[model samples]
Target: MSTETDPVRLSFRDVCARRLEWHGLARPSAGSRPADVARAMAGVHAQVISGAELGVGLRIAGATRTDVRAALWGDHSLIKTFGPRGTVHLLPSDDLPLWVAALSAVPPPREGFPEDVRMTPEQTEKVLAAIAEALQDGELTIDELNDEVIHRAGSWAGDLVMPAFQGKWARWRQAVHLAGMRGVLCFGPNRGRKITYTHPGRWSPGFEPAETLPALAHVVKSYLRAYGPATPQRFAHWLNAPARWAADLFASLAGDLQQVEVEGIAAWVVAGDTAVPAPVTPSVRLLPYFDTYAYRVGNQPPGLLYPGRARDRVLRGNFQALIVDGVVAGLWHQRRSGGRVDLTVEPLVRLDAAQRDELGVQAERVGEILEAKPRLTIGTVTVGGHA
Candidate 1:
């Protein structure tokens, strides 16, 4: 009585364990290659500089903040750009060609831009073109980029400004992301405390635009290699793209992927990537807000969902997560006061002596990365929210 949608297949526990391998949480291969890790996670969230560093550092073998920084700013091997939901991320430099080509093809969200700063598709294209010219062989902070856009695109582009977290952002400010999505611009080294922008083509010399279909296929394979046995709907959600687009892309590549069942639901992963490994050693990870894995699969992360307990999903809008052996077990905070960084953790369950000691070491290491002495404190975790 097995059907495609309800096939007897791998246990939920097995699925969780395999996913941990994909996320570099399980017993993973030893390597400090940033490109490999970035490709694995699809991309790493980089809105918070330190968090993104910690997120990548934890996943890669013996990676350091210096290594992440060098990849980002020094070596120019990792391109910082906005991807999926228009959020900032550190994507591997070599992969930029395909990533941008496919992402640019995704139609804008149906709700469209706010009336206060709406744009025609033609207007958006012009803004992207102007941004490419301004950012060539030089860097500009958001403020400077805004002025440059108006200078290049005319005063009308300036009128396309909307209130944002920092200030009113011009319509061109939005399409500047399109410049990134189209493989033109990326983040440059910060001048003082303000972030700057530049051309990815200059930073990553070999960059060239690719065909959309092949680029979509490459992205799909990359995604499945790290987070597979996924449905088109999930892929669409991950990229914040229209459902029809993702479905078409997946269908076109159906012969290339292997069909598998995830807890009786049919899914597809890159061919030959379905092999599950042994369970991961129990350990704890202190992940910052917006950690890529924090956006776990299904309702909960693989580790949290397996072993069958009546528990809710842990990923939320904003909260630093404490993950234990691949499951989000709690939330944590680190704040610097004077010369000391206070580390506060709210554990969902009791920790043994060994676990506590392990946590202390992790806390001290976090302090080292932030270049401050750490003070560790463990508190009781309540049913919901921070206690």
Candidate 2:
């Protein structure tokens, strides 16, 4: 457990600790082709150990909203693709087809949508083609893009048609993926707008495309290396992929991986893997809502946060989290008005003075990032355990 006690054979917690140093800052490109970032973190669940850095860290590191977005998708194809929950996710470009192929294996559970409403693979292909044609070399704002999509799909042909009769274009996640493919959907350029759509092919020239299997293998390897001391089931959950396919990914990575036990459960870690060291004592981090680290756990051990509660909050359009000693020790929320950011902290356990000091400092820093300061208020600390 101590850094002095053998640097090799990192525990799950240990692996999570230094992830930011290795995976984010020390990267060759400071984590460029941000999609590669997902692949790198995939070694651990395709979730970065750091999750969404809070406002404090952003100010301290001089990272803006644009920087974070760029850092997350530098070269990856899809941001919100398949994962354990059929939710949107950021994925590496090379692994996109494989992930799409794997997740598309079984039709997603049809819930409220009628069976007749399902779009077959052929139909989806047609949709993609039409979309590609309309957006291939062009850029459109969200409204313009939606209109183009409706027009190109011929969904707006007649007024008598039922709203349900129109074929759906891309959902939030898919639209982002299409943008990734086109290259115009980049950081800024759109500048703090919602779902700004652009052509990727026009944005970054001379982009290199990696092969599918190799990319898949790389993703599998990265997850085990970064997040390992984890299992295939955990990975399948993180990727929103099939258990069998996760197992296959593990099998393909046999020679490059090693297995270990944490608290009596079996898991795998990459051989020769070393963890980045955290401060001698644990540190606290203020994380943004929906940070990848906050959501990567898929019904597994070393439980990080309140998944059910987090999911509920996200569904309700609200969430803020805190990381203590490299784990999601609490949830938080912020309110911004009149150029001031108000922070509320609800911890699962009691915070010592040191933790409070660290948390307060981080909170102030985050406010600075948004150019909103002191009118910064730390709400009453609520004490409770994470369910």
**TM-score of each model, in listed order:** 0.88, 0.68
- Show where candidate 2 strays beyond 4 Å: 1-60, 69-113, 150-194, 206-209, 274-279, 292-318, 374-387
Whole-model lDDT values for every prediction: 0.73, 0.50
Per residue, candidate 2 scores C-alpha lDDT tens digits across 1-387 of 112223244455555555544444221242244454455555222223133323212422554444445544543243433243444355554454444444434233424333444444554454455555666665566566656656765553222222233654333223333333322233223435554444434434544344556656655665565556678888776665667877877777666776655555666666656445664343676666455342356323434433444434332343456666655566776667887777787665567999888778677667755557634344543433222
Clashing pairs in 1: 160-171
lDDT of 1: 0.73
lDDT per residue as tens, model 1, 1-387 = 112443336666676677677777664347656666777788887888788887777776656678788888788778899866677888988888888888988877774567768777787778888888888879999888889889988888987477678877666666766677787788898999998999887886777878888988888887777667677887887788888988888888856877778766677777666677887555776777677343553223444432232134344424577766656677777777887988888777677787788788778767765657989989743344321
